[model samples]
Target chain A: MKKILLLAGTALALAAGTMTASAQEKLKACWVYVGPIGDFGYSYQHDQGRLQVEKELGDKVETAYLENVSEGPDAERAIERFAREGCKIVFTTSFGFMDPTIKVAKKYPDVKFEHATGFKKADNVAIYNARFYEGRYVIGQIAAKESKAGLAGYIVSFPIPEVVMGINAFMLGAQSVNPDFKVKIVWVNTWFDPGKEADAAKALFDQGADIIVQHTDSTAPLQIAEERGLKGFGQSSDMIKFAPKAQMTSIVDDWGPYYVKRVQAMLDGTWSSTDTWEGMKEGAVVLPPFANMSDETKKLAEETYAKIKSGEFHPFTGPIFDQAGAEKYPAGAVVPDGDLLGMLWYVKGVDDKLPQ
Target chain B: MLEAIILTVITAATPLLLAAIGELVVERSGVLNLGVEGMMVMGAVAGFAITVSTGSPLLGIVAGLVAGLAVSLIFGFVTLTLVANQVASGLALTLFGLGLSGLLGEGFVGTPGIKLPSLSIPGLTDIPYVGRILFGQDILVYVSFALVLAVSWFLFRTRGGLVLRAVGDNHVSAHALGYKVIRVRYLAVMFGGACAGLGGAYLSIAYTPLWVENMTAGRGWIALALVVFSSWLPSRLVIGAYLFGAVTILQLHAQPLGLGVPSQFLSMLPYLATVVVLVAISGNRRATRFNTPACLGAPFVPDR
Candidate 1:
């Protein structure tokens, strides 16, 4: 795309101008946050990674981040600016940055590039993402235990792979708990609108969704859960304060260790292109502090987590049914990568349909 | 079913109606400003920052208005005086506003937002049909209805309205007739910018009450479309905005009722409808006749 070319040109200009041969070898890593780091959601979690790199890598690694970079020509400019900073390693954190990352990677072939939640990979560029579906599936199990009507609510941002993956995982986990569990969904079609995100949560709450989740990057749903005295999970970090009593647990993204390791590898000459899909097993995905759980609920949660981490159980196991009750997944079989990435429909346990 | 939808419509329409009404006034005065998104974002950041600092939501709303006005004045000066391209300048304003807002609002994005207390009227709030839908909302929702009526009256029934309309239709005629066309448009642009800011403040201080990047989303564009969909008539804008609100709320409902459609598809409905209606109503020759000013989106050259 033209956007990709412009980004590459900008990176080339910046890198050409900003590079200086200093006495000490400095590993500069730049991060592009799609949302503000303050939003305890997507960008916030990534910012944590930057902080981790600072602590773990110490003086050898230097971290610089730019927030609220939307996907467009504007983002290309930001990428150019980061590249110009002589960043040896840059992480563009969003699916929309897929092409721009590749383009920039081409320009700065020496620079190690890591993109989150993308499929493209090259000698100079790498792709990485957490098993977010694993987290959702775990929460789904908790929702099944808590809800009397076995209903879960989701405030999804779009029909993209990320959102679709979460929906299916939640259904899989919830129904595994209570076979009749159903999830109701609302899509605001935006990644970060607090107003719509809250409204979506409230609407679902009104429909008696005792356990709620959101695919958008905001704390609105968690806050609403606290206000209404219902259990819920946090997005990127621990949101225990939002719903102290109601929050069973939260899905936390721990990117700091990974970021530090990547920077260290670049310094030690061990860095290479990789497509990492980390999960709870690798400690890339984490659970927030459990709040006010009953003895039985706590046991149920711990047991489920153990099974997931140990690979004794998976939420994507088959004999799963689609909305039409067609056998989408067979017993003892895992959902394939193709179906999971292009997930366009809901599982049988979810009442909602995938939008056109 | 209708009650919930109508209430949802009112809430959804309030912010759009407020911003659209302001844009209508600005466009009528011959200043085509496309920085509504920027102004709204400025308002959101300013409003949220002030609210957190002062602990008073009212002051936050005022700060948002002033901030929005300041952003608009910049656009007005560049377009009205320097004769820059209105479209490019406006989009530039939005990009700048977004950057500025993100920098300023970085601290408040994911934290728990300030809680607004809902106002309760004695007997009216307790009334059977009206109690739950109309009277139970926060102060901003009620204020939005009043604003719609007031804007409608000001645009169609006041002396200032006539002057504004004259300036938009033909700045030369208004200038020859001894009216300060440029000054009037400038003032109108500032006022409109303030309203857009206030609408954005409402999102942070009242509606959602949390600061987030691009929190206004495309609501400002939707508001701009509503101006045309309303035929630049304030009353019709009210109807259109609420209809959008209802559609937005209805979207969340259909999925749970087993409508058998994906929520993502449902989410696209409002935007799709906006484009479809824009094409339909805008295509009507008679309606299009009075829709645009003679100098719409054109820079005014005082000497040329």
Candidate 2:
């Protein structure tokens, strides 16, 4: 009996040792998405980033993802589950996941958490975002040059600083070309709802706004533009296929490079909590090839893109005035990044009032 | 501008009308299936997939209707045949349908869909404001109106409709009277599934012409509420759907008008209207009870 017990103990020890050795062989990185990857918009682009991580670091890492995770108690549970599952890194991709990410990070201090488009962070939780407003400025210029009515319809999702910043940058760009250019803004208050987006597009078009700009993540508005023989810009992914004749250009979110770099940091034992806000210069926010626009307009858009990329132009340059005609920034003084990140007030020339 | 607003309103209202009319029938037969959203989403994915593969929106519509009916059979089997709890079974059906549709629609995501062409009558469709409103709609819009009228006529004017309602009101009594309660419910549930599917297909093939997961986006739940809001009456269902759709669209228009009202408040108008209307309707206890199915959400088990 004593001899048999010794043999069994030896076997169990060997099995446990092999499990630890295998666990050390590769790092596990996980992601929590707010919307389904099939959205082909915001969530789709983020999943592309995850796929890139897997492709670039094939043997060194194992990746997992939970799509369509709602941003509330559900997000916290998802993040906690990944942490408990021995994930070396967790990426929560939504602004609404900010507090939840922070909450989970506290419980799992060793797990590195990366959150997108959120402000709050902890010692173990890092925050990162893309300067989507940069591309919005370029689209704004295109809208100004292309719009025959000098009026553009803007379809927006929420009243977050991110969306508000995009609206301001667009207004600034439009005003640069046509000083009196106007935009009619409609807030549908959702990140994605194709039907509502379509309805908003129709409402804007009916109100005499010939050009459409959407901050929401769907191709529905662009499809509406194609149906009406009008033009608009695409969001998140290149939606040219959905609206071949209507898409002037698209603001594509490319998070693959940054994702690869961070995962590499984890493997190299150099991972730390850091805030990152990358833009066109880093290839984080890109605009696809211009189409359905005049050469002159395309050239103008390209120039704006190059300037923003080279840091030669800032969309929020001063001499800026709020909608109430109050000067927010003096001439020759650019709006600081801090102000832009938390911007709530609308720039002058925006047709609608900001929802407080 | 008026014509344009009216056109947008019609598109918005059509899907809700289609889904609600079907649920109205299901509830009238004493079965409250909360799986309308699931069935609708399944229809959307199936219709979009078929349309993409065949390059024919007509076939896509048919596929959606068939897919919806097919999914409803699962519900019918569990609740009617297996004698499972109807509420629990219906909710499970929704979750299952959503997950299954996502898996099925994996390849079709990000692909563009062919639009269902609207009916265009040369001389008749171009008449100033009213012409386009009445004659320029897609085939589904007309179909929705006709379905409502037909359902109204069937429920109020046909012997079959009376029997179905009797089954819903009191299954024991219905069975005692030699009516096949379980069989009547199966047919009613299948019809509901098909209509919900058609509504979902309209979304993918016509309204937005794309398929995304959860694309129905709680429209199914709205349809369920609309059934109650309409007091299970077909004509009132139409009014309730249009009212909901109109408020949804008009609120978007109202946003840019700078009325000093917050956009959030405008967004809330539709839900608020639903609650107000519901309260007003429920105040009339006689009317509410008269239309509500007595055996709704109750499972039936036949005696040997």
Candidate 3:
């Protein structure tokens, strides 16, 4: 009887140990940055976020990344490589990685895919991006408060919704302060050629634009702003180095906590494939590191930040009118996630002069 | 305006200056080295990778030259040794170089690059408008100019230059004279590779101060055009390169002035100028033949 009882206890202990060991297995997480994480801006900030995951969840998580991964096939192959390496979770850090990521997610249902700056949804693939348009609105207000030409120059990459939304938001924000403010657009047909971006910025400035903002990556436009002595808001990351005096501020992307949270969710078995659109409230999007503003400008930014955080002020509030004088948003109806994320139109306060 | 123009020309001309001079030597030896673009791109990646690794500007240049030479040798084997069609092989070389650069420069994209240091000769550098424009440039710019002069003198005045030209004009005749036509051509091809590599190195290291995918931004083609546009003459390359450079830089200035011209049109100015110059220089076929090598594209077959 005693021998049988001891054997039963050993069997129970073995099962318990096995369960504990499996529970402690570190979750495999991987990331693919569209550009090198050290670019001092967009990609760099994203990389910083990935690093944050490692930092926040030391032994519980292991992270890997392939920097400078191209948007097309290169991204697909990298994701496959990551999934094959036992990664339970993968983050595709660009808008272009949407479909490719979704396709990959379908093949590997066990692994989760999180795509940044995209809207595609799937059972295993979740999309997420910062609400950058909100910050642009705040900076636009600062630009109007600072400059008199009441002309805002935009250095744009494509006619994509992401770029368009920023332009419209900036126009609305600036117009709120300066009703006569007009936003001019220049599409240089590239994402990150500083020389071209700077040249575009200069052209806009020469056309009587005293304030500048860019959708393109790189500090080139800010460099031009410094040279021309114009006020400007940064793109992707705060580029104060490019234009210390001229840089009003930028919308900072805090991807670290987001990465860490998703990793934790995987650990807790609560990880789901859900699109996440978080802004200042979730600490996903941060105001430029710190604005270099006049006292009045600082006050305006602080109040805007507080209002935005409390959900009292929405940048795309009701009674919004399109460039063609169309009533896009009804009274008391704020812009929805669908239209805002894929926005390809301008607001009433802004001009509709696109480049030929 | 002239200073800006001159500044633009030098910047634009360096890559072409490097590639054309390299091609000019190959042509002089009856070898049509169409691998200039490939060699330049290899040099670009090699130079960028080395600079990224070592952070030394000089070592980066040496690495670029070796990269260019290695790429050219691949072309040399296929064309010179195999006696393959020069035009097709050169195009292949370009395709290979571009792909190779994209692969290698993947990690370098969006990364801050090593900026080539400039030499400020106090008196010349501070000469009012010219100071920042000319004197503020790095040593490579000066080297490019020097290379042009050195090449001009070599082609027009030196015995070795004459022998190489003889080989290019007609390797059969030169080979009969016991000039070792094959050996001379080999050296010229290597020289072209080295220069093209240096040009690419300049693009990655000095001018942009950053690396992006396909960042040479069609400068390789411009260098090829510079050779023909200059009628394969060294001095004329300087003039052509600077003019192209001026157009590139002026657009940067013009767009800001918000001139009535569309931004896309302004951006296309440099390429447009290249087309115009190419057409203007290649005006008379007969006149071009006088300077162009007669058996330029023909393979050398001693036994045949």
Candidate that would win on DockQ: 2
> What DockQ does each candidate score versus the true complex, computed on alpha carbons?
0.41, 0.52, 0.13
Q: Write the per-residue lDDT of candidate 1 for residues A110-193, one digit (tens) a residue.
A: 888899988999998988898888888878877788777678788887778778888888887877778877777777777777
Tens digits of per-residue lDDT for model 2 on A1-356?
01111111231121111111133458999888888788899989998999899888967887777777777777787778789989989999999899989998999999999999988878999999999999999999999999999999999988889999999999999999999999999999898999999999999999899999999988899999999999999999999999999999999999999999999999999988899999999999999999999999999999999999999988888999998899999988988878888999899998788888
lDDT of 1 at A190: 78
- All predictions: root-mean-square deviation over Cα? 4.6, 6.2, 9.7
Q: Summarize candidate 3's per-residue lDDT along A58-168 as a digit string, tens digits.
A: 668766676666778767777776788788999999888888898889899999999999888898888888888889888888888887777778777777788788888
Residue pairs in candidate 1 whose N, alpha carbon or C atoms collide under 3 angstroms: A14-A84, A318-A329, A318-A330, A318-A331, A319-A329, A319-A330, A353-B262, A354-B262, A355-B262, A355-B265
TM-scores of chain A across candidates: 0.90, 0.93, 0.89
Candidates in order, interface RMSD in Å: 3.7, 6.0, 9.5
DockQ of 3: 0.13
The number of the candidate with the highest TM-score is 2
- Point out the worst 10-residue segment of candidate 1 chain B by lDDT: B1-10
Which has the better lDDT: candidate 1, or candidate 2? Answer: 2
Model 2: pairs clashing at backbone N, Cα or C within 3 Å:
none
Cα lDDT of model 3 by residue, B25-109, tens digit: 7776777777677788788888988998899978888998999988988888888888889888888788678766766776775
DockQ, prediction 2? 0.52
The estimated TM-scores of all candidates read 0.89, 0.95, 0.75
Off by over 4 Å in 1: A1-24, A35-39, A66-85, A99-109, A241-246, A310-313, A317-347, B262-265, B275-284, B301-304
